[model samples]
Target: MNNENIIDIIYGNLGSMTATDQKVAHAVLTAPKDAVNYTISELAKVAQVSEASISRFCKNLDLTGFHQLKIQLAKVADDESSYYDEINIDDVQQALTNIKNNKVAEISNTLASFTTPTLKKIMALINHARILQIAAEGNTYPVVADAIYRFNQIGILAIGAESWSTSIGQTLNLITDDVLMIISNSGESKALLKQIDVAHKQGMQVIAITNRKDSPIALKADQHLRTSVRQYVLNSDYYFSRVAAITAIETLFLLLIAENRKRLSAIQNHENIISTDKI
Candidate 1:
C-alpha cells in the first residue's frame, strides 16, 4: 500500500475502514486531486467529521497529518482533469465555442452523478416531504423559483426563499417533515452551514445541490446532489455556479415529473387556472 498511488491505497483500505474513517476516505476519494488541495478544516467539514478524526485517519494510513496526506495525493493527482495553470485567455469566437463545450460537459458530468436508484430515492423523498423549501441566493434564486414552480405544478408544496433570513426562518417555523433544499456554489465558505445546522436542529432533512461534493453545503446534506465538476486555479476569486447548478436543478425537476406522473393531473389543473388569469 505504501508503494501504491495514494488514491489506490485509500480504495484498497476502504473495506477495512471504520464507518467514521470510511466517511473521510469517501470524501477524499470523491476527487483525490481536488481533495489534495482542500485544507484540513475544509476536508473535515466536507467529511462531516472533526479535524481530529482526519488526523487519526492520516495516522491510520501511516501519515503524520493532513499535510502528509496531501503530499501523497499530489503525487497521484489526475492531470487529465487538471487545467488550473492552463488559463484560457480565449478571444471572442474561441470564448463562445469554449463556453458551449464546457457547458455541455458540465451537464453530462452533473447527470452522471445520479443513478436510476438515486433518482428514485430523491423522488420518494420529495413525495414524502410535507413542504419543499428551496433556498438559494443571488442569481441562483431563479433556479430556485424554477424548481418551486415545477414542484407546485406537480402538486408538491414548495416555496422559494431567495434570502438567507428566509432560509433560517423556515427552520425556526417549519415542521420536521419539510425538506430544505439548498442550492449554492459557495464552496469552502461557512456562510450556509448555519442554515444547514438550523435545519438539522429542527429535524428537517436537507438536500444540497452544489458544484463541489466536498463543498460544505454538499457534505452536510441528508441528500447531497452535485453538479458539474468545476475547474479553476487555486485561490481563483471568480467562481460562478449558475449554469451547472441550473442544469442539476432542471434535471431533478424533470425526474420528479417523470417519476410522479400521477401528480401531473395537478399540472393540467394549474394550467387551466393560470390560463384563466392570463385572459
Candidate 2:
C-alpha cells in the first residue's frame, strides 16, 4: 500500500470522525513522529481515549489494528523528513535542486493518482459539453484562465469568470449541456460552493480540481480530480504552490488534444494567427 494514502484517508474522513476518533486523528496529524513511537496503550493515553477507540480509528482507516497504523505513520514521518532534508536555505544550488525534485515528485504523484476511467470521464465531459465555464479565486485564477485559453485554442467554447457576481451570473445561465470547472487548492471556497449549488440547480455538471478529495467543493462536484502534493509546512493551515494543480490541468489539456486530432490543426492555426500579429 502507498503509505501516503494514510494522510489522504485521515483528512478525507475528518468531517465524519467522532469526537474520540478526532482526538486520535489530531494526535496523529499533529505529531506523527510521536504517535509512531507510541504503543496502543500509549496512544490511547495520549489521545485521551480507550484502546478500543484507538482500534476503531485504525479500523476506520482500513488498517488491521494499532500496529499497522503505527507502521504507516512511521512511513509518513520518514517521507516528511526526507522532504525537509533535501532543501537547505543557505545554499542556492541546494535550494534549486530541492525545488526541482519537489516539483518532479508533485507532478509524478498527481499523475500516478489518476485512473484511466477517471481520465475518460473527464474527457467525455469536456468533449461533449456545449459550454465550459471555469471558476477560480485568488492564486487559482491564473490556472483557470490558462485552462480556458487551452480549451479555446482547441476550438472549445470555454470561458472563465473573474468575480463572484460574474460566476453567479454565468452559473445562472448554465444548461444541461454545460460544464462548470472550478479550480481550488483548499476546495473549501464558500463562493465556489454557492456557485456549484447554482450550477447543479441549472442541470450543469461540475468538475473540481483540488488537492483535498473530500473538501467541500470536491464533495459537491459531479467529478473531482485530486492533486497530491506535500503541504507547504508542518501546519495544515498553509497552502502550497499550484504546481500540482497546473500539472493536472496541463495533463487534461494534452488528453483533450489526443481525443480530437483536429484540435492540433486548430492550435497551429491559432499559433499562426498570433505569429503574424493577427488578433
Candidate 3:
C-alpha cells in the first residue's frame, strides 16, 4: 500500500497502538507531507512524545527514525499508485457526503490556525465603521453578496455592488469611518485591486479574504483573512476551495452579527416603532 493508505491504516487503528505510538500516529495523520520534512527531535516534540518512542513508532512501520520513514512515505506520495484523478460522474449521495467531510476538515483547519487578535480586530472594525462595504469578483461575488445581506439584516449601512463602476461610484464619497471587505481567491484581480487602493487612499479600512497571502490585494488591505486551498491546474475540472473560502466569509459574518446581537435587536425595535407610527 502507498504511504497515504498506510497513513490511513495508522489513523484507523490508532487506538489499538501503544499510547506513545498514538501521538506519533496523530502527527503523521494530520500532516503527512509536512511530517516528512521534520527531524526526529522536531517530530517528537510535535507529537509530544519522546525520541525513543518515535523510533519505536517508525519501527512499527518497518523503518528507522524520521529519515527512513520519510523516504518511504515520500516514495509512496510520489508513486503513481497514490494518484487519483477526479471522476466527473458519481453517485450524488456519495459525492456530497465526501464533499461535506472535506468542507468540515477545511473549516476546522482554518479555525485552528485563526488568530484571536485578527478576529478581535475584525469585530472592532465592524463595530466602529460608519458603513461596511463588501466587494468581490467572479465566484467570490457570492461570498461578498452574502456578507452584504447579513449586514443589511442587522441594519448596518452595508453595500455590495456587483458592477465595477457602480462600486467605484459608491465609494467616491467614502471616508475613514467606512470599512471594505474584498473577497478574491487568487488575489490577482486588477479591478478589485484598484478599487481596494481607492478605498485605502480614502482612509477606509480594507479587509481581504483571499487564498494568496502575498498577492497585491493582501498587501493593500487593512486586514486579511487568509484561506488555504490545494494548488491545481487552471483547467482542472473540479475546484475544491470555493466552498472553503465561502465558509470562511460566512464564519466571519456570523461572528460579526453575533457580536452585535444587542445592537441588531435595538435597530429592529426602532424600525418597528417607525412602522407602527406610520400605520
Candidate 4:
C-alpha cells in the first residue's frame, strides 16, 4: 500500500518507537534520497540499527520486509517534492499556506528526533529528582519558563536559573539526583557549556533540547532531545522559530502527565482545585 501519509506516520511516531526502531526511522527519515538507494545492510549501518531491528521496524509500519520498505520510501520520496518546498516567495494568501506547511514540517521533523526510550528515561529522571533546574538564555528563556510551570504542575520542584551558571551553588546543596534541563537553540553558548560541566561534576542528570544534534550541549548533556528545523532568513536577520521546541516540550509534558494513574489522579485533583472550567 502506497499510502501518502506513511511518511508522516513514520516521522511522527519517533517518540513512540523502540530505541532500535527509532534508529531505523531516523536514518531513513533524515535522508530519504540516500536511504532509497541503500541496501538493507547499508541502511542498517547508516541507522546503526541491526537487520532484525529493520525488519521489526518494517513490521511495525505494516510493511512486508526491507524490500517493501525501500519501495515505499522511494515512492514517498518521488511524491514529496511536489509539496515540500523550502523557498516561499508568495503573496500573503499563499504565504499563509507556506507558514502552515513550514510549521507542520517543523513539528513533524522535531518529533522525529525523539525515541520512546529516551523520553521514558527523561520521565524517570524528572519524577525521581528532588529539583528540576532549567537553564536557558535569550530566546530560549520562554521555553525554560514553560518547562518550570509544567514541571510544577506535575508536582516537581523546578526553577529557571537564567542559565546553569546560577545553579552551580544550588547543585552542591540539593539532593544528588536533581535534574538540569537545558533549552538552547545554538547549544554552543559558552556559559551554558560551562554550566553543563558544572552540573555533571555535581552529578546532576543534565539533559538538553537543542536544534543542533552535534552542538556542545547536545553532545555533553546526559541526554539530548533535538528539535532541528529548516532555516529561514529575511531582511538579513535569521528567523528562528521555536515551534518545534515548543512541540517537543509539550510532547514531553504530556508524556510525563501520562506516566501513571497517580499522576492522572493528581492532575484531576489539582484541576478540580484551580482550573476555572468548573463554571
lDDT assessment of candidate 2: 0.80
For model 1, the superposed segments whose C-alpha errors exceed 4 Å read 1-91, 187-189, 229-237, 277-279
Estimate TM-scores for all models: 0.64, 0.77, 0.62, 0.66
TM-score of 4: 0.66
Q: Where is model 2 more than 4 Å wrong at Cα?
A: 1-4, 7-68, 71-86, 231-237
TM-score-wise, the better of 2 and 3 is 2
Best-to-worst order by lDDT is 2, 4, 1, 3
| Candidate 3 minimal-lDDT segment of 10 residues | 79-88
lDDT measured at residue 112 in model 1 versus the true structure, 0 to 100:
64
Error of 1 at 31 (Å): 18
- State which candidate has the highest TM-score: 2
- Taken over the whole model, the C-alpha lDDT of each candidate is 0.71, 0.80, 0.68, 0.73
Error of 3 at 216 (Å): 1.5
For residues 21-111, write the lDDT of model 3, one tens digit per residue: 8778767655667777888899899999899999999787656556777876665454322222222235777656554555555565445
C-alpha RMSD of candidate 4: 10.4
Q: Top model by lDDT, which number?
A: 2
